[model samples]
Target: MHARDSLDPSRSIWHFIAVHLRRYREAHGMSGQALGDVLDCDRSTVSRYESATLRLKRAHAEIIDRLWATNDMFTNLVDFADRADEGDWLLSLAEFERRATRIRMSDTSVIPGLLQTPDYARATLMAGTADDPNSALERRMSRKAAVFDKENPPRLTAFLGWAVLGQLVGTREVMRDQLAHLIELSELPQVSLRVVEKEAGAHPGLDGPFMILTVDDRDVAYTEAASRGRFLMDPFDIQEVAVRYDLISDIAAPVGPSRALLRAELEKYS
Candidate 1:
């Protein structure tokens, strides 16, 4: 009955670990609660790991290896996955968004993709001269379904720069709908939209956009640049990204005022 039972091990290295971890635990006659005790997490966390909904950390793999006498097989697999190039960065990021228990995004550029309207996304993609602009736009628009159209969606807190709200993307109507969408998403129980006004001025997020996803009690960060994005899994890197988000959040407008600002910006297009 566990969702993990349906996971195809060939999907990714994480999936391979997830499907096999459950099998190994069951073979050893260990209950999820018992395994959770060893992992210093709850039963639900163990279940998430088994479902590959939460990523399995390398340190956890080592611990499992020792506890189960698996001869470091899991450790080696995690190492291999880590050593793999960023070519699969988007795949990993999609997985992170789909399964993250908490997500923090800081953007000083355009509206964060998760909150962008269809036309806004298209405009941005077209402006970028994307390799496959249509496909890219489709993917950007689909994150709403992938990350939100589920039983338990991740709690997302997005901190965006003030310029993002005023800077035009597509057309007046596009910007209007996009700004309206920001307000709409902010009303959700799990979504927080905070705007950092220009008056806030210089800040850590001014450098660029980054995201931190908390999954399986660990944090993974993704930093974006003009061309490529790097996924950061090291504790230090994740902490750095977390610190940056917190700093940016420190200067963001409160929720009520943020909504008021969003509504104010939406009117400009009217």
Candidate 2:
């Protein structure tokens, strides 16, 4: 199917701008190549924008606004759409975590957000966001903080891949404090912390990290990638994540040994 014909604009936040761009372009009797010439891009980029598959950068949006004589309407809408899409996703995930009765997670690179100390969180956010790190840090930390303050917080079982324990994030002191925090949380009644050693060999979890959230009796799976988070609601997909979690957890060090391992790592930091 042609990308343009298959687009369902109603499902896209940028669809409003896309519709307007196409309408204005057609009304002006301009071809996609003609519009691309003004924007310094190609026809494919123009088609992608009109199909809602790609969003325009501010500089490109500026050129479009001037060419189409739409004043700042296109640029304003683009900005609003970008922020709304990002904010809504983050808000929904935070709400999901709050309502979950249980959260099972696997981390292959670094400590899970819920287990990170403020220093570790701040340092990690700085490395990731680069721009406006403080704002991002505050928002993420707030979500984690609120989740734990609930009167009946979710039961959390975190499976830390072997490499996660050895990965260095932030300063040694910050890492020491972070590991100390993990050890303390491991002792909690509702939290289970396990260390999956590399000796376990390859497993399904090697695919990527994922979380299974249990709300009421339903299970939802969440995975994050660069600049986006995906939620899997299909029972089959959710079940697969649950099975992966179980397999990874099976090879993880038990609570007693996990605590000892953490303490040994902490000693090195000291």
Candidate 3:
């Protein structure tokens, strides 16, 4: 996932376990309520466990293993959960980005997270089905803060599709504010912003948005769809995406023209 993509480490461990639980449950044709009954917990608890909102206890894991007939997956999950850290995943990304020397990003429908304004983020959060939109917005904003912390910032290169600049994420005023923020951010010395015009013709990134984060030792790619995002660490996949990104970069407008394009779009909202 991108540095801005939120993942709770504590929840991730539990999420991994929960996925196995779901697999085992489905394999046995068991409903959540039925599984909850076996574990002597409420059905909602089972749901929460599966969703990674709550961790599974060893006793509960044992019960699930017994009921689902899994050999040792539950036991392994219990051990993994017990040793999981409670740190926010964003912090780890922040640390990595801070130490990283280069960052490259591409966005198709909207600005990438690190370059988003609060108004843009709020609109994005409000558009989501999240139970706590405000908290989600806060988390997103916090991630953005890490990129511009001033202590040690990575060189940022962002390529945004022309369609993204035209998207009215919120009210015209909000979009205007967002575009202005984008213009300001693009002017930062360490940051370079480019626009991939709609008429630039078809390209590999026509598939979707992705980010390449480069640290001293390794490079990681993050891609996302509507509901979920993934971190790509395999060297081969990263290299492939990197080549595609470089191709896209070649056709995108340079920084100056990109800023002008953004400014012109922002003017429409005024």
Candidate 4:
């Protein structure tokens, strides 16, 4: 499907702006950095705008319209910006987390967000990018505050791939700190940590990692790829994926065995 068709007009204005801007840039053969140069900002700034980290400005929207020679698109974006819900996406996610009585996640690569220490998050972000490592690290660190700062956080049940436990993300000291953090989080009364050992046979989640947030009225499943993240709200799809996740969890190690696995992996880094 085309990128433009993916946008929902009822969503935040930034979402609308980002979709169109990305489409225009791709059509014009303009790399984000090239566009950033035209806008007198850094490449990462362009990325943040696309990611809706930075708010879109009216002037910038006008510039983009002029550059792309779009007749009414610029005016529409400017009007949307004036009354756009500020940080609506993040607010929505935060509300989901807050209202959720339970959060179940299955992760194959990196540590789950609520369990990550700063050092571990830094290492993971750095490994994925060719840009400024510090900036990437900072962005990741900023995201963690939402999960860790709450006084009454949701119950968290996380199943990690054994590879994540075995992988050394940073220096030995950093790795040690990360494991310690995980161990501490696991001890929380509302948290459950499990590991799917490498020896565990094929399972439903072998395809990829995903998270399910169980709120008051419904559940939402989230999946992320290299360049995009999708939130699935359709009840049928969510129900199917939730069933698959449960089967995968059942086939993996139980909580007792998973904690043992984590302890052994921590020793390797120590």
Candidate 5:
């Protein structure tokens, strides 16, 4: 079956835009190549956009609006989507993480998922909502293998807030094991793990936790919140998150010192 045949418009704003845009084009008896001509791209790109595999940019929406005299509906849809939060971001996250060449992350609340140990992940999962925490734990644990065990794993640069070392997810043993695991991951050539000391004293890094992923030569970002995280696709949004990661990385301890810090914290738990 074709990708668009199974497309669900209600899945996300991106899907909504793609589904409707294709709808409008088909209703007017327009072909993908013709639409691609108006959008100044090749047919495959138009195909991806129409299948909701790629985001439909606001600029493209405006061009379509002008050509079809749709009263800026697509442009307006893009605007609404800009302000909206994408709660269903995990599928996209996994898809992009698999294709990523680089990943930069800054976490203020908990250990970043990719670096988290099983006990630590279990603790965090138990604290949150999960229909089956055990199943969730297994899935959570698989994320590390999924990303790192790939033939060419993405290079990872991670900044963990100092408080995270002492955050106390499960037990002293669990925390200690988690720190030890981090120390090990720090030794990997592909992973550069750092610690961001609290004394850095109030920068935009305090804004929250986020990760920027570089996939297929393009940048995308994910910003987490108390409830749900949002995927950022727009160039400006990606830039802002990149700046946040950079700011935090600047104050973050170097990898060697960060590993030393982890060891020091581990001694405390010992």
Candidate 6:
């Protein structure tokens, strides 16, 4: 790590964890690849975590604690870091997502990030970030667990614009795989997937994609643009977004038909 990078921990909570992670790993004379082997991940993943490009998951932190004999220190720090991370918009979204009991979203440009496959996410993230696309891709993929948690998964309803099916992201094969994954996810009882037809034309969703995350019976609205993201906290703002979601949802094809639509599109790619 560069000297300036090493000294940046005081500016961000994740940097503090990163600095210590590198310190303890090196103190034990362990290479990044060696540490990753113990963690059942790759060297790049370990490097991203140490650089704060990727958030350290709680389970990973616990394993590190045991490996380094840190006595739950890393565990406590992971918890704090999750709550304290405010430097990255997506990171904050991941934090709130894990706590949400319900999620409703509408996407016009592409598949929502939470529901994206690795290849799909990589393609989309690569178009956005010039610095480290792979790290951003991994960070986005890590957040999917919020929707897939078997013990207490959030109820997710996603409305995708019909154009999303036709848009070419990475490759024909990538979209084929992603559409297949969507079919499987739609089968889950807690997930409701729908598509707004191109014919639906100029709906409220044309403005942009937005998400409503429900936590403790309260809803928070999140909107993402090319350059930045906004988290709407005012009750009125959240309610308005919720209302728009309902308007869009009403026009979307229900899950059964949506799966058929996905399979139909899958054939084109195949």
Clash number for each model: 0, 0, 1, 0, 0, 0
Q: Give me candidate 3's TM-score against the actual structure.
A: 0.67
Of the pair 3 and 5, which is ahead by TM-score? 5
Task: Enumerate residue pairs that collide in model 3.
Answer: 1-231
For residues 128-176, write the lDDT of model 1, one tens digit per residue.
Answer: 9689989987887677678888898999999989988889888888988
lDDT of 4: 0.71
Candidate 2 lDDT by residue in tens digits, 231-270:
6755677788888887887788898898888888889898
TM-score of each: 0.76, 0.67, 0.67, 0.64, 0.78, 0.68
Off by over 4 Å in 5: 1-37, 40-54, 58-87
- The candidate with the higher TM-score, 2 or 5, is 5
Candidate 2 error regions (>4 Å): 1-87
Clashing pairs in 2: none
Q: Could you tell which candidate, 2 or 3, scores higher by lDDT? A: 2
- lDDT of each candidate versus the true structure: 0.83, 0.79, 0.75, 0.71, 0.83, 0.82
State the displacement of the C-alpha of residue 171, model 6, in Å, after optimal TM-score superposition. 1.1
RMSD of each: 4.1, 12.1, 12.0, 13.2, 4.5, 13.6
Model 4 clash pairs?
none
- Higher-ranked by lDDT: 4 or 6: 6
Q: In candidate 3, what are the lDDT values of residues 58-169, reduced to their tens digit? A: 8888777776667766887678655553333444455555546688888887788788888888888788887788887887777677668758788899889888998889
TM-score of 1: 0.76
How close to the true structure is residue 202 of candidate 4, measured as C-alpha lDDT? 75
Candidate 5 — number of clashing residue pairs?
0
